[model samples]
Target chain A: MPTDVIMPALGMAQESGKILRWLKSEGDAVEQGAPIMEIETDKVTVEIEAPASGTLAGLRVPEGADVPVGGVVAVILAPGEKTPPETPAGVEPMVTAQVPPPVQRTSGRGRAGRRPLASPKARRLAAERGVDVAALAGSGPHGAVLATDVESTGRGRDGSTAGVPRTPPRLGAIWQRMAERTTQSWQTAPHFYLSREVDAGRLEAWRASTRKRAGYERVTHTDLLVKLVAAALSEHPHVNAQWHEGGIVAAEEVNVGIAVAVDDGLVVPVVHAADRLELREVTARREELVEAARTGTLRPQDVGGGTFTISNLGMYGVDAFSAVLNGPQAAILAVGRIAERVVAIDGHPEVRSMSIFTVSFDHRVVDGARGARFLGTLADLVEEPAGLVP
Target chain B: MSSPSAVAAQPGTRELTLSQAVNEALAEEMRRDASVFIVGEDVAEAGTPFKVLSGLVEEFGPERVIDSPISEAGISGIGLGAAMTGMRPVVDIMFGDFMTLVMDQLVNQAAKIHYMSGGRLKAPLTIRTTLGATRRSAAQHSQSLHALVAHVPGVKVVLPATPYDAKGLFKAAIREDNPVVVFEDKMMFAVKGPVPEEEYVLPLGVADVKREGEDVTLVATSSMVYVALDAAEQLAADGVSVEIVDPRTLVPLDRETIVASARKTGRAIVIDEGHRSYGVGAELAALIAEDAFYDLDAPVRRMCAMDVPIPFSPVLEDLTVPTADTVAAEARRLVGKE
Candidate 1:
C-alpha cells in the first residue's frame, strides 16, 4: 500500500501550507523517515518527512502550490509499485472523488479550549462568508478575531477565496452605506452623466520623469488625477459643491475621496486639502490613506467630510464605467485606463494615448451645460498638467 | 512480557550484566591497542568495587593497569598527560561526587588542552564514571551529573542504559581521539541484555530507538530508558502506541533522530532521571519545543525527577525519581487518551 503524504499543519492557525522546495525528486527511492519537502507557512519554514519507506512517485501539488492540511500532496509507493495510471495532476487524485465534508471549525466562544477566541460577530461573518475563522490571526481586543479580520484575510489572497462565498454578506458598515446612500441618491436626486476622452500621454510621461528626478519611491497616477481634479474644481466650483436642504453649498475644503475597493465593500478615504499640497505630498498622503483602507484600520476622520469622490477602475483594464453620487456630494468622477487608441488628428487617423472620464452629477445641483463644461475643463487640465504642479 | 519492538535485536547473542559488558569492552580495546591503559584509585587492585575493571591488571600487567592513591586531581592529571603523550588512558572516578576534587584537571586541563594549545596537543582520554542512586547510596554516591560534564565543551558524554550499548559505545569512546566521558547508571549495573559474540562498535552521538510506535515519541536517557520501555508496555495494553528514543551520547547530541521521531508522532514526552530543573530533560524539552513545535499536536511533556535531593529512604527515593507508572500516566495525559 502506498502511504499518502498529507500537507502537515504547520501551526495552530494554519489550514494549508505552500511547499517552498522539494528535497526529493519524484520516482526516487526514499528512506521511511527522510525529509522529502520543506513547506513555508505563517512565516515559518517546516521540513516534512516521508510517512513510509518507499519510492517517491506521482509528484503532486508541485513546489510553490499550497495544499490544505488534510489534502494529500504526494504518495510513497512500496518497492516495485508503479504510479497509478489514473492519478490526477495532484494527489487526493481523481477529480471525481467525493468532496470531503466541510471542516467543522471548533465552535463556541469560551476560552481554554480548541475553539479559537473570537467575537460572535466575527463568527457570524465567517460563517456567512464560509471562511475559516480559526485560521485567521486576530487583531481585535486582546487578540479576539473580529469581522474585519475575516475581510482582510480574504482580500489578502485577492480573489483566491477558494472556499469563501461568491457573494458576501450585504450588512457591514461599508455595505449599509453603499445601500442607503445609493438608494437615497437614485430615488431623490435628479442625476445626469457627462463624459469626455482626454489624451493623458504627456501627464503619464511627466509623472514618470518627476518621480525619477525627485527620487520618490512611489508616485502613482491617482496622485496626478487628484491634483488635476482639484485644479479643475477651482476653475468650476459648481461641480464641487454639495446639494443640501434645497440649496447649493460650496465646500470650503477640497477634500477628495479616493474610493478604495476592499474585499467585501468599497471604502472612500479622503485626501484632505488636495489642491494646496505639493504633488509629492499628495502622493504620500494618498498612499497612506489607501493603505489604511485596505488594512481595515481607517479611523472615522479618514473617511469623513468629502465634497467629491473619484472611482478609478483603470487598474482593472476597464475603459469606462459610471458611479452613483455618494449622497450630498455634487458629483462622482469615474476614471478609466489610458491606452493607445486610433483617433482623428486633423481628419487623419493617429494612435494616441487616451482615457475616458465620466462625471455623474446631481442634475438638480448642476445643469447639463455646467456639468459638460466641468468635464471639458477637467480634460484640458489632465492633458496638460505642467501648470498644476507646484 | 516486553513488547516485541522494545527488545532490540543483536546479530549473535549472549546474556551479560551491564558491568561485565563494560569490562569486556575495556579489555578488548586494551588488547587491540598497546597505547590503551587503565588508571584509577581502586581500578587496578580492587577492580572498582563493581568489578567493571576486574581482570585488566592481571592481563595487561601493572604498568598498563596502574593503580593510584585517593587523589582524584593527581589521578586525572596523569590521565590527561598520558593522553597528550599518545596513550589512550581510561581514568575511573570511583564515585561521581569526587568530580569536584578533579574539577580543575578534568575541566581546565583535560577539556581545554587541545584548544588552549592551538591544536598542538590533543587529550585523547576516556573518563569512566558511575551515576544514579544505588542501594540508597544517599546524596553522595547517588547523583546523575551527566548534565554537568555535558555542559563543558571539548568533551563527549555517553550514558548507556543497556548492556549492548555499554559494550559497543565504550569501544567507540576508546577509539575517539577527543576526551569522552562514559557514565553508566550505577543502580543498573546488574541489568542484563543480549550481547553480540563478535566485536562491534556503535558510533557515538547517535540515538537508538528502543521501541517504535505511532502515538507518541518518548525521549529518555540512561536508566529512564528502562522506565520508558516499561511504560510502553503499560500503554500498549491500553491500546496506545508509544515510541522510545534513547540519545546515547549527550555532547554531540543526536538532535536529528529525536526531532524526526517527535515530528513523525506529533507528540513528545521526555523522561529523564535527572532533576526536573536545569537537567537533561529541560534541555531535550527546549530542543524539541524550539525545533519541532509546529509538529506537535499537544504540549511537549517532561517526566523528570522532582526538583529535590535523592532521599535516603527507599520509599522516598522511589518518589524522587521517575517511575514506570508515572511515565505511563504522563503518556496518557499527553495523548489525551486518559
Candidate 2:
C-alpha cells in the first residue's frame, strides 16, 4: 500500500500550508520518520517527516503550491507497487476555493477515535490557545505531545471569549493537586493576613548597580526576599514551624517554596536550607528552580520539604495579593511590584519607590505578634538592602 | 495475616496439623451424615500415606468407612457407584500421580454422571489427593495434578494451603453434590495452623486474601499460598505491600477476588506449584489479562514450579518447586518495586 503524506497545520489559525520544498524526489526511497519535505505555514517553516517507509512515488502537490492542511502532498509506494505518472501536464496544485478548513488529522500518532495522544500540559496549552491538538502528530517519547508542540503563534485563535466559561483544556496532575491542596489549606487552616509597605528605593538601586558589577547576571527583588525571608525565619523559627496535632513543631532548617506560575497552575519548588545560602547563591538556585518549574522537570526533591513559601506577582505588576498557606508551612509571603509613590516621611510628603508585601499565616502556629515581628524584620532587611547582602 | 478477624483471631485457639484438620473435617462430615461414607485405598486402616483420614474408620466403623482394594480404577468405580446410589463417598488417591489410574471413573463417570444421566444420577463424590515437590518423593508420587481434573467439565478442584482451609474446604467438598477433587499438599501434612474448634465449611470457589496490601497482588494456589504469604512479608520490609489471594478451589476459581486485587494494585504475580506453561499460573494470568488488562501498569507475572519432574535429590527437589524468595523476587519485578 502507498503511504499518503498530508500537510500539517502548524497552528490553530492555520487552515492551509504552502509547500516550500520536497527533500526527497519522486522514486526516491524514503525511510519513515525521516524529514521528507518542508512546508511553510502562516507562522512557521517546518520540515515534515515521512508518514511511512517506502519509495516516494507520487508528487500530487508541487513546490510554491498552497495546499489545504489535510490535503495529500505525496504517496509512498511499496517496493513492488506501481507509481502514478509524474506531476501530470500543467496540473495546478492550488486548493479549490470551495475547500473548507482542513479537517485536523494526525498520522503515525493517531489514537483510537482520533482523540490524539498528548501530555497533560500539552493538552491544557492546546485548549487554552485553541490549538487542534488532535490534528498534530506527537513527537515526545511514546508519541506524547508536549506543551511546546502547541504552537499558538499561527493557531488562528482570535483571543475572543467563546461566551462560555473559559476553562483550561486540562487541569493536569500539577493543577489537580494544587486545587485539592489549596482548598484544604484555606478551609482548614485559620488564616489571618498581614500587609505592609516598604521603601524599596534603595533595594531597587542596589539590584540595578549589582547587575552592572562584574560576575553578576541579574539581581531580582525575589532573590533579595528569598534571602531576607530565610534570615527572618531563622530569627523567628516559630514562623518556619508546622502546625501539627501535637502543637507548633519548629523545623530545624529553612526550606523555602517559591511559587511559580506555569502554563497550568502554580508549582512551588523548594530551595532547601535557604538560610545557609548567600544572596548570589539564592539567586542562582531560585533561577534554576524557576526554570525547572517552567520546563515541568522539577524532581520530587525540588518540591518537597517546604517549611515556608514565597509567592511573587511583582513581575505581573500586581499591587498586592494574599497567598494561601502551602502545606504545613506556617507562613507565605506575597510580594507586589515596586513603583514610585508619594508618601509621608517623618511628617513630610516625599516621593519614594515603595512595594507592597502581604503575608498570610496559620494562626495555629504563628501568633499575630510573632508574624508581625517576622514581617517587620523582613521589611527592615529589604528596606536596608545592605543587610540582605552577603 | 494474623488470622481471619473472628475465628482466625479468636483467643485461646489451638493449632491443628493440616492432616489432623483433614481427619477432623472427615470425621465431622461422616458423623453429620450417615450417607457420607469413606472408600479409598488403605483409608480405613492406614489413613492412606499422609494419615489425613486416621482414626476415621474406627470412629465411623468399617461399614461406613470401608477400605478399598489396591486397584485405583476399581476403587474409583466403587466410589462413583456408591455416590450415584445416594451415598457421598470420599475417595483418597494415595498420590496425585495415581489419580491417572482413576481418570475414566472421575472424568467420564464421576464428573459426568449427573450431566450424562440428565439429573437421574448425581455423583456426590470427593476425591482427596496429595500434591507437592521437594518431599524427596520421586517424579511419579510428587506430581501436582489438580489441573488435569480441574480441566474436566464437572469436576471441582480444591487445594487448601493451611489447616484452617483444609478443614473448611474438605467439609465443603463433602457437602458439594458434584465431584470435587481436593488436592492436599504432601509437604503440608505436618504443618500446624490455627483452626476454629467449631465446625464451619468455608464456601468452595471462594478465595482467601492471606495478606492485605496495595503494591502488588499475588495469587497462589495450594502450597504456593504459604510461599506467597512469606514473600509478601519480605516485600513488606522493603516498603512494598503485596496482596496474596489464595484460590482454595481451582475449578470454580475465584476470578473476581483475584482480578479485583490485581486491578487495585495494577500488577499481579501468580504462583503455582504446577509447571509454568499451560498450568494454574497460565490460567490465572490469562484471567487477569482478559478481565483487568487496562488496570495493569505492567504485564502479569507468573512464578511456577520448574517444568522438570519432581527430583529425588533434596536440593534439586527444592529447586523444582516455587519458593518464597522466588515469589518475592517476581513480585518486585512485576511491580517495578525492585
lDDT of 2: 0.79
Task: List the lowest-lDDT window of 10 residues for candidate 2 chain B.
Answer: B1-10
Q: Candidate 2: where are CA atoms >4 Å away?
A: A1-390, B1-12
Q: Could you tell me which 10 consecutive residues in candidate 1 chain A have the lowest summed lDDT?
A: A93-102
**First chain TM-score in every candidate?**
0.59, 0.60
TM-score of each prediction: 0.50, 0.53
* Residue lDDT tens for model 2, A139-184: 4444445444554334535665333222234334456668878999
- Candidate 1 Cα misplacement greater than 4 A, ranges: A1-390, B1-11
TM-score of 1: 0.50
Q: Quantify all predictions' global Cα lDDT against the true fold.
A: 0.79, 0.79
Total backbone clashes of candidate 1, pairs 3 or more residues apart or in separate chains: 0
TM-score of 2: 0.53
| lDDT (tens digit, per residue) of candidate 1 on B1-338 | 12224445566788888989999999999999999999898888688888888888999999988889898899889998899999999998988777777678878888898898899998889999888763688877777788888889989999998898999999999999889989888877888888889999999989999989898999989888888888998999999999999999888899999999987777788988777788888899889887876566556788877777788888888788888898899888766667
Q: What share of the true interface contacts does each candidate keep?
A: 0.00, 0.00
